[model samples]
Target: MAGRILIVDDVATNRIVLKVKLMAACYEVLQASGGADAIASARIDQPDLILLDQMMPDMDGIAVCKKLKEDPETARIPVIIITADNDNTSKINALRAGADECMSKPLDELCLLARVRSLLRARDMSEELRLRDSTARELGFAETPASFTPSATIAMIAATPVTAMAWKTALGNTLHDKVVVIKKEQALSLTKTQNIPDVFVIACNLAKPDEGLRLMSELRSRPETRYSAVVMVIPKDANNKSATALDLGASDLMIEGFEPQEMALRIKTQIRRKIQADRLRETVRDGLRMAVIDPLTGLYNRRYAMPHLARIADHAKTSGRTYAVMVLDIDRFKAINDTHGHTIGDIVLQEVATRIKDNLRSVDMVARIGGEEFLVVMPDTHLDEARMAAERLCHVIDDRPVILAGDKGNIAVSLSIGVAMGGLHVDVRDVGQLLESADKALYCAKSDGRNQVTFSRTAA
Candidate 1:
């Protein structure tokens, strides 16, 4: 079926242009001039896809996206943010707002149409799967009970650095597509991140019942993850600890020597008894994943950025150690995006995101919160140190021109970065504010002349 679409933009020209393209593709189209009307139409008309504008007079696109996502009725509807701005910060905000896609403005009609079709297809496919599953369950003979069924999904965390295949034996060796392993240490340390595992599989040997128990207790303590499960593997001889482990709030226990098939059976049995339990576990794990992660870049995002910022702030306050934030901007980004188009713009953003990540230390946090805008949370860095890093990033981006589509030549872009450091006035949330201050400095650099770095303050 041709999908219904909503094009939300304040610009009449852009709206008209989009309408023409969507209509040509046989989509039933709706138009909203700004964010408020868009939300109203979204709830009422329930369009299949929405093309949201980043900057609107009434409400910005990011705010609009968050509002829609917050509303249960409108939440599942996908939003694609369209903007002239191609800075990292703006892109970061869009993803954080749960924007399904981002398009830098001077829109490409073909790209827009293609994206619309793709999203609609995906939405339809998901709905079909859900309905089919429901139908199969109703016809009991046609469906295997979730326990013995290979289809039941369980959220798992392979905290032990073990391969996923091993977890299947107990968790359902059915080879679940969703099963994944994230480093336990990485997940644990990223407390500020949004993505947390549904169930944590800690080595009974490595993470003691005490440590695992503490984490499990904390997971259950949080209203968000209270129902989430924790699976622990203890030595077979450690009979005393199993009771203690369960008491501390572990949902399941595996001994050191569970065969693969046996392990899968245990997991399947759990799935049969309480499907919602698996769901609850997934909800928490997924929420944890979202909690501290920056959705787009896969870098440690806003959620995790807080504690690190505060730690730096604290270190700056107590010790003489200082850190700096470089508000980085892509030079002439709008032009690159305008001339080549947003798909290419997306490629550029990913490249720049990669380059910035590669150039940073493990101690640093790199985030894309906006279109073509980036923030580097540099711990123990002074303005000089931060400036040097900015300079390095600028050179790195400028050093190579990325190859883009449609015979588009290699394009090289420069960066304008603003530097700011911590003192008494800085709060953790002020990282955004600090970034803003640095952005102003970066703007100054751009205004003065592109291809250079500028500090937020003229004086120390």
Candidate 2:
């Protein structure tokens, strides 16, 4: 099934009719006879969306929507309220109660199906974000709560300046958000530095018939404006374009003309949703970053470095070039911690990491593999180049003294490096074997004298 939809109506015929339509579209349909039963089914079944009847003997659609929004379990599911009343009041009330859409009775079948597809698509995206967030929380990386709400901006684009200004005035009476009137050309030419609106209200007949659809597509394709919500305003004679508008990524639509209250409500809903999606995306990015980065040193962790080194080895094999791996350890790191305290020891480790990073090329990989040890992989490098780079790292560390905080003085630091070569002339293909060879070389460096470089005889 494409998705699961719950139909809630007091009448059996209403439920059957809606179920048949949804099932024809490859959707699994569930039914409820009243508002109370609908809420129960929603909490238990966790359907992707709900299609609700406005007037029921037990409770109204607006009340049901408010109840659902108040509950955490069913709050995120999208709800569309079907009402027999065609007045603007009903639409505004339903929207204020947190209904995603309000449709009048004698529904247009094509437009209804298009709206269903759009809502289901949005719900699926939200579900995926929630799933990732759940995983992040389980990994002990919870997202920080937002401190404040930012004011939203809306851009109004119409066929003529007069129409644009009229829309601005109508929306201004009800909305406190910043609304700007712009031409089609200006809308498409927005820059990154300029203020980007949170929502766009576009007329379908801008300069020509169905020209706004093309504009919407352009906005969707652009990186800066792709996430902004768009509401297409269709004329009374152009009802056939409603499905096209929704399919082309319109968040909502205003038919015939604008009703100030209804338009304001719809715009607010779009802004709320956009903000939520943006926050979820940011949390997911932060979680992924935290998973592979060392918090103290800000270097790649062991989890990220092992796979990365294997990829470099694979590339070297295909290109028929040589690569080098180096295992580095801070000499007498534990004694430094015991003598200067772990706080100063951390400072020394950070300074050493910085020096090693600055001396290496951008293509080289460096990671914190243990408390006092780091791994570096250099591709397309021979034994001589690797020796020179390792020597350079040793000289750079021993040359300077890391300054301590407060009245304390400076402490000297040095590194012992182990080098191993692989690919082309080398027979080693296993990453574990390469690491073991380098580790043996590192032992040789420690045994001979600290603060020096050693090469592995096994691989080189």
Candidate 2: clashing pairs of residues: none
User: Using TM-score as the measure, which candidate wins?
Assistant: 2
lDDT of 2 by residue, 1-460 (tens): 6677899999999899888888999888999999999999999888889999999999999999999999998998899999999888899899899999998898877888999999987876775566455545655665675967788889999998898888888876677779998888888999778898899999998888899999999999999898899999988746579999999999999985658888888898898888888887787567656797777787778876776677667656654667899999999999899998998988988888999999998567788999999999987677889999999999999998888889699998889999999886544358878988899999999999989999999655
Error of 1 at 401 (Å): 0.7
Backbone Cα, N, C clashes tallied per candidate: 47, 0
The C-alpha TM-scores of every prediction are 0.37, 0.64
- Tell me how far the alpha carbon of residue 39 in candidate 1 is from the true structure, in angstroms, after superposition: 59
Question: Across residues 277-313, which tens digit of lDDT does each residue of candidate 1 receive?
Answer: 4433343234434544456666555544544555566
Clashes of 2: 0
lDDT of 1: 0.66
